[model samples]
Structures are given as C-alpha cells and as structure tokens.
Target: MSERREHAEPFPDGSHGDLRADCERCFALCCVAPAFAASADFAIDKPAGQACPNLRQDFRCGIHRDLRKRGFSGCTVFDCFGAGQKVSQVTFGGQDWRRAPRTAKQMFEVFAVMRQLHELLWYLSEALTLQPARPLHGELRLALDEIERLTLDSPGALLGLNLAAHRQGVSDLLLRVSELVRAEVRGSKKDRKKDRRGADLIGADLRGADLRGANLRGAYLIGADLRGADLRLADLIGADFRNADLRGADLTGSIFLIQSQLDAAKGDAGTRLPPSLTHPAHWSPGDRKVGPVVGA
Candidate 1:
C-alpha cells in the first residue's frame, strides 16, 4: 500500500523561491567581483574586483569536483538568489565583461548591489508565507515591494546607491514581523535566554532571551529563536547557529564569535550588530563612524 497521506512541501522556503542554484542566467558575477583568500573556504587568492582564475569561458568552476579538497567551502555557501542572473541579463541587458570591456567594472558593481537587495527579498518573500506572521503580512508586503524595486533598478542606478539606510529601514520592519511570528511559536512567555551549556534544545523558543555573558560553547543551536535576545559579552565559540533566527539579537559586545557564526545566523534590522558585520547608515556606534558608501 502506498502512503498518499496529505503531503506537505519538504522544503519550507521553496528553495529560496527558485533563485539560488540557478546560476546559468548569471555570467558568474560572484566568481569575478568578490575576492577570496586561501582559507578552508577558498582554494586560491582572488581580488575583490577581479575575476577568479578558475572561472572558465562559459562561467563554470574549473575544479568544481575538487572544491572541498581545494578549500572553497565559503564559495559553496554563497547563494545569489537569482539576483546575479537578473543583474546580468535584465539590469545590464546581456552585456558582459568579456564583450563590453568598458562597462566591466560598472557591471560588477551593479551585480554586488543587486545581490544584497535580492537576498533581502528572498527572506521577505519567505516571511510572507509564514501563517503566524499574518499580523505583519501587510508590512512584509510593503518591504517586499520596496526590496523588489531596488533589485530591478537599472544597472547605473544600482551602482550609484549607498543603501545602508535602506537596509536599516527594511531591517526595522522585519523585526516586527519576526516578533509577530514568534508569538505563535513561543506563546505569551518571556522566552528568556538560558546558559543551558549542554542542554538538548533542538527547537527551543529563545525569543527575547537574556543570555548576556552566557557560555554556549559547542552548543547545537540550529533553528533556535534568538530574536531580541541579549547576547552581549556572551561566548559563542563553536556554537552551531545554522538557520537560527537572529532577527533582533544583540551581539555587539559578544565575545569569541568569528565571522563564520555571524554569516550563518539569519539576522535583520532589530539585530544589534558588531562592527565586523555590515551596519545600517543610521547606526553610529561609539567610536567607529561610518564612512561614505562607495570607493573610487
């Protein structure tokens, strides 16, 4: 007997809404613009604005099979959410660095900007699908509209912007969305953060948790609710924050958290940030002032 019970989608977010893993439309933009250092995540040294040596004429990885052995785990982690292709085809109108040498640098800049905006859109779009966040559905829709507009701008316009403020605004709206969604997930509870050093909290409701100065070393925190949690002065060394909701967590004073963990967390506007991470234009922490957006 075949089990035909009511079936639900195995993947919740619709595979990033069909954007990631679709690099054919892109002209391998990420492989060109972002530089990589020879680390566990990269096989070679690449410059920020230069094309990767491994990028072939057809824009495919040359040593793709041996990527892990060669040390490019970081490259594998980056997903463009179809923004690469959109910028390459729609924004730039099929122009490429190989063909239009004069427009190469400008094209690369547009790709970078569109990638960030599209990433925001992907998350917002996912937020729209969550049932409990209905209270903030209207806000999510508005954010999605704004984010999509930015994503579809002409290449020239995208390159001319310093959207740190724009990101901040969107992040603010996203925080409210997360809170509403959390209500159904956690009920009417403080959901305080706990030290619980070695607890088996596979799917704990840690929203608004006060985990400041806590030690979560080697903790398995996958898919945990870290929204609005105070993680200041916390030690998160070796913690697995993969797919965790850090929408509004404060990690400004957190200790021992390298870039790898931050990159894994799903953070938004309410997330009190560290200088190591990108900041919105409006937030000017103690001594470090944000400089102009672009570089010549």
Candidate 2:
C-alpha cells in the first residue's frame, strides 16, 4: 500500500474526507486482492488473494520509497479512492482477511466492487465543486448520495450489484456535467468539432497545441508529446496519459482530470493543474529542452 495525504474537510453527506486513499486504516487489501503480471510496471507475477512478497505485516509496502526502481511502479499510480479503508473499517468493521480466513475470498470480491463505487464518488465530488456545472449539482448530488449509500451495503449486496450498468448510469450523468463545464470555454465551432474523445493518439506529438475545451475522454495518449499544450477546460475523463509529456502544459480547470492520470504521466513544475490536484512527486522539478514539435 502507498501513503496518501489525508483530507480532513468534509463534502456533502460527510463523504469527501475519505475520498483519497488512506493506507493506514486499510488492511493491505490492494496488495493482496489484485493479480499482477510481470511487466514494466511490476517486477513479478502475483496471484489474486496472495500477499505480495514486499507487503509488510504492518500493511505497508516494503519498497514504498523505491517502487519505481524495484519495477513496481504500477503500485505507485494506483488510487483506490479510499475504498480499502472503507471496506476494512466500515463495511467489514475492521475484520481482516488474515484473522478470518474464510472471509478472504469474499473480502477481495467486495473490495473490487467498493473501489469502483468510491471512484464514482471521487468524480461526483469533483463535479459538485465546478461552478460551471452548477446546473447539474442537484443531479450530481442525488447521484452521489445514492452511490454513498451503496458503499455501505453488505458484502453480499455489493457483490450482487450490476456494476457495469450502474457505472454507465453515473457516467451518463458525468458526461452531462463535463459538457456543462466545458461549454463555458469560448472555443470556435471548428475547434469544438475537433472531438478527440477515444482517439488513438499513441506517441503522437501534440506540442503547444491549443486544446482548450477539447474532449479527450478515453483517448490513448500514451507517450504523446503534450508539452506546452493548453488543456484548460478539457474533458479528460478516462484519458490514458501513460508516459505522456505534460511539461509546461496548462491543465487548469480541466474537468475530470484525476490524480491517477497525472501520476501516470510525465510533468514538471511548469505544468499547471486544477486546484483539487497536486503535482505528482515523480514529476521533475525543472524543465528540459526538447526538439521542435513533430505534429502539432
């Protein structure tokens, strides 16, 4: 498990405080519940329900400070949206899988469901904060309340949920929120028509592009050169930013830009971000000179 900052202030229904990962209150559920294949992100193959060799008995990562060097970088970018602690402390009442061996399988299954629900809460909380999305606040709040209620469901009830259908319903509402927020940007009709939603831009050069109010939802931006790009007010929900160069990019006020997406990208001090997100620790402190833009 990775260390995360604690958010003390509460949001609607007092659910915002626990939207960020808090590994201390968790039971190392992330480390044991998910299966990992040997790849650039992970150094070894790990099976579901089995503890990682690097997981300490205290539920902390053994290579917490050196996960990148240890080839476990994937672990660093993972954000459970505080679902681990919620399941461990609230749903299960602090009952750990180890102490109750019979509950291990069910606990892991519920963790999966709880993680998705918590992620929806994170996005909804952010949506409620956007002034441009004020028109949808009532809808967003109602959705948030419903999801928060679902989070407290018993493990059996959670596992019985049709997560895909539920997620689609929330995603539809979020899409409306994104449109409401992004529409505040005064972009030309031509620019507005340049919808990059789910576009395949892998390794494409996008340096210094004017992408304000662009729709990049679910776009494959892996290794793209986005340095100095203006991404303000862009809809970045589910965007794949793995290794994307975001140095000098202005993403201020970008909608649905989550910390995990930024964690997977390469950025620097010059990369402007929304107030809700912080610079990833892995980002460089200084900018580096690069060649001219390839495909603007």
In order of appearance, the predictions have TM-scores of 0.62, 0.92
lDDT tens digits, residue span 1-296, model 2: 65354322323356487878888899999999999999988999999989999988788888888888899889988889899999999989999988888889999989999999999998899888777788889999999999999999999999999999989999999998888877756467877775899999999999998888899999999999999999988899999999999999988768888878988999988888775667777789754322221121
Candidate-wise lDDT, in order: 0.63, 0.85
Query: After superposing candidate 2, which stretches have Cα over 4 Å from the reference?
Result: 3-15, 286-296
- For candidate 1, lDDT tens digit of each residue in 68-127? 456665664465657777877888888877888888888888877887787667557656
Model 1 misplaced regions, further than 4 Å: 1-18, 185-190, 194-296
Error of 2 at 136 (Å): 1.5
